[model samples]
Target: MIDSKQKGMIFNVQKFSVHDGAGIRTLVFLKGCPLRCRWCSNPESQLFKPERAYNPNRCLTAEVCGRCAKACNEGGVTLIDGLICFDRSKCTDCGSCVNACPTGSQTVYGYEMTVGEIIKKVEEDDVFYSRSGGGLTLSGGEALAQPEFSLALLREAKRHRLATAIETCGVYPTEVLAEACKYLDELIFDIKHLDDEKHKKFTGGSNEQILKNIQYVFENFPSLPVTVRTPVIPGFNDTEEEIMAIRRFVPLRDNVQYEVLTYHRLGSPKYGYLGRPYLLGDVKADDDFMRQIRAKLREYQG
Candidate 1:
């Protein structure tokens, strides 16, 4: 029996997302991930527990609003030269300052929500789902990392007769992947690199388990629609040889599709908000190079 009351740490519940799944969809971003990819955009989603993020640009100077500093019991927030300064080292992530902030600048990234509550919110867009063939898509730091809660959420979503999907890194146990597929209508899996060492070096986890899990999915669930994506990060999997290695690994079945996602620094600023370093720095993806690779792959396939 699936428990609707089971809670999961969710970072964001993005609405009207058109990328993760078919048509317009509601994306539930789950918190926690096993692998820490250097180019990861959602650094806030990396940790399991909720953390506070301070955006100085949105802060109404300390002179106007010192509420955040006043609310900080740990002396983490302070006013410096008309600017609100946050000392992340002292902050406990208790969310006191986030609550005190009048402007939306002080924000907490992750929060706990029950499957029942999440479903209730998702059902609000039932009209859009019916017309656009879109429903719930679970994205994360890694949805499979939160196995029980994620599975329960999927089951609950299915009970509501909604189309369900998940964007997974496929780094979990095959058992978890097996269970998740039963409830998922679409599977968006990331195959970062075929080489285990390179994969580990870049994403901080070996690709052996990931490859095995993905292979298990294909062999067992032949009917499930799978979209395998490779984020084209410069100095990583940008070369045709590297990308092709992964393309060769994935089976070319009718139900399986492959795509390359261009890397971007869109989430670099978030690192500053979270007081974390953006490892990728000034590196940028060559869109033209990626396009050429895609064309070459098609030609090779033909």
Candidate 2:
């Protein structure tokens, strides 16, 4: 058996995904990330370790029965003022609470899988990949968070001559980027905000490292295609100035491409699942707004 040290924690392995890369692809969703973006669609992906999510709607209160609290040895489950209170501080995230819950209210986020296991799954879609000009794309929390496992997975894919891609936030160490660039045919890097303060305020990290890595990828990966994506959020980086700031800095001319993704509030309900308040409240970006942003970007598109 392969040692556990080489395994990666995966949240999901989605098949036939079109938006992740070119054509039909199998996208492996790795768990854990370095950034804590307030508007992150997958709130479950931020933590490096396994964490439990509680759904109040599905939870049959301790009043219904004390199954979860009884199953938890760490005293992590509690009834606080007639509501189910999961004390994450005391929790070991052993999945006991999830398993004991009769209503399926609790769910755990991460798991370990070897590189060989992931490659086997990727090969299941080999025919689709061949037919549609697509293969495997490693998506994250930030694939580089699990650098060795991500690289191993990509290396195995390359052995089979499959096309490989990575979607990153571009904040990883330069050495890691250098190694990954060797295997990756394409990279979709996220550029949240050009202004360091605003970027830090929302994503809880500065854009300094991200921008540096982006420039490094653009310059070094001359033969590979790179796309810089920005999640356009209202009241934060929704204006022409914010958009242009990132555009002019990145210098997307040839293989480097610029893309503006419309922000969706679909993950709002996810905050409730994770027992946290949604930061953006009811704020949302409309289609017309996205059209304007796209049009504005087209004005500068090469």
Candidate 3:
């Protein structure tokens, strides 16, 4: 039974997505994450609570619309020399400024939604799923970070006879992951780096747990189809040696596969909105570089 009252923080619900999993899918981006990847695209999904985002281009000047200032009870929004400034320290993310904004300049990132509510939304694309072999795919900030809510969504989705999948970093407890795998149809796992120290330096977490969980899944769930993915980041894990390390760790089998994702700065604009800096500034992974990495990986896999 889907928990109608069990609400979890959600940041986005992208429909008609063909990237994360099989066929066309609806990607449900949950809030909160355990690891702090420097190149994270969805900066808004990192926190467990609702946070505000600002769009300068969409914002009307303070002289034109002072509604946000009026709505902010904490004095977080103020005017400075005819320009608007946001005092993040004083802000509580009450979402009043978001509501008051006329042009959608001020917005909140996370919101609460029950499993039932989410399932209802996903069901809207029922015909599409049936035709294209698509269904619900849970993504994050780390889907398993909110274990209960994520499990509820998975169970509820399966109860409805929908194909369920999850893209996880495998940072959660091994027991929890084991339980979750029972309800999953497909799994996209991330193995960023084999070296624990480098993993910690880049993602702010040890690779011990992640590697342990990956082994647990592979050894225990041999029949389960798993796709191991690595996002090739410049100045981090971009070299052939790094890719070879990952390939050696999780060698492909009948149900296991490997894929590499090229790094991009497409989400740079989001950092400006969230009042955060995109750490990987101007890092480019051109087509030629990615092709070389893939070619090397194939040679190593053989």
Candidate 4:
């Protein structure tokens, strides 16, 4: 077994997270992803390498001096239309500009961390986890994409006697997932679309393995807590027919819960900062539409 003291590259370690799993939890956001979902809310989590992000809203006038531009060696920082223009490709992610920018315009994604370091961070809130039944939640661009590191981290958390959960896209191999599942108390799986072709078109991968994995987990570990989440993306998989198709796959077991997450533009800005296009521009599911979809799913609950 690999030593848990080995460090892993992480994007963020969010603490006191409540919605990710049972109770108040610490969410470890791992880097790297295989699928490129158009509606992904955390685009920064996709790349394994560190990236530069420019927030124009946070830019200060060059009249104060272009210290950020002077600090960059890759010609990534430039002034355009009175706003800072960052060429992500030219960025080295050295964090020099981020430090030199008095206005906080330059920011970098991804950080290096070790399993022992993360466990120490999580242990800080041990009291809260025990009191509220909350523990650690492993989330990512895709946690299984970094299986070895993730598994090791989970093992370390278990050694500390903390409950663990994983939020996965279900795009990985069965063997890898099975190994990780052994250390998890709950699994939150994302099911974007029931149709294979549609799923491929949106998430850049077929539904063949994803659906199979869910079925496999349910059939083999019926007692394990599982939640199936569907992000209701507009013009994609938000139709009543699509929702009902997903409902059909939900196991009749009372331990399983199905949820429909309404789409939001929260991560659109990340695409811009990364110098990538935002496909779902200004497209978000309204509250009324989300409610209707939820109501439609309720009809099939019985």
Tens digits of per-residue lDDT, candidate 1, 126-153, equal: 8999999999999999998999999999
- lDDT by residue (tens digit), candidate 3, 138-200: 998999999999999998899888888999998989998999999998999999999899999
CA shift of 4, model 4, Å:
2.0
Evaluation by lDDT, superior candidate among 2 and 4? 4
Best by lDDT: 1
Full-model lDDT for every candidate: 0.91, 0.84, 0.89, 0.86
Candidates' TM-scores?
0.97, 0.88, 0.94, 0.94
Worst 10 residues of 4 by lDDT: 1-10
Model 2, C-alpha of 272: deviation from truth (Å): 2.1
Candidate 3 segments exceeding 4 Å error: 300-302
Full candidate order by TM-score, most accurate first: 1, 3, 4, 2
Q: Over the full model, what C-alpha lDDT does candidate 2 score relative to the true structure?
A: 0.84
Ranking by lDDT: 1, 3, 4, 2
In candidate 1, position 266 carries an lDDT of: 91
Task: Tell me the lDDT of model 1 at 92.
Answer: 84
lDDT of 4 by residue, 1-302 (tens): 55467667688989999999999999999898889898888999888877677777677767666788888888888777755567777877778889998765777888888888899999999999999999999999888888888999998889999999999999889988888888899999998898888888988889899999999899888889999999989888878888878988887678899999988888888787767898777876778988887887787776
Error of 1 at 71 (Å): 2.5
User: Candidate 2: which stretches are off by over 4 Å?
Assistant: 1-5, 58-90, 101-103
TM for candidate 2 is 0.88
* Candidate 1, run of 10 with poorest lDDT: 293-302
lDDT of 2 by residue, 1-302 (tens): 23323689988899999987888999998988889888889888888777688887887787887688788888788777877778878888788889898887888877888988888889998999889999999998988988888888888889879899999987789889889889987888999898899998988898899988887877877878888889898888988888888888877568788888888888778788777888877887877878987888888783
Candidate 1 residue pairs in backbone clash: none
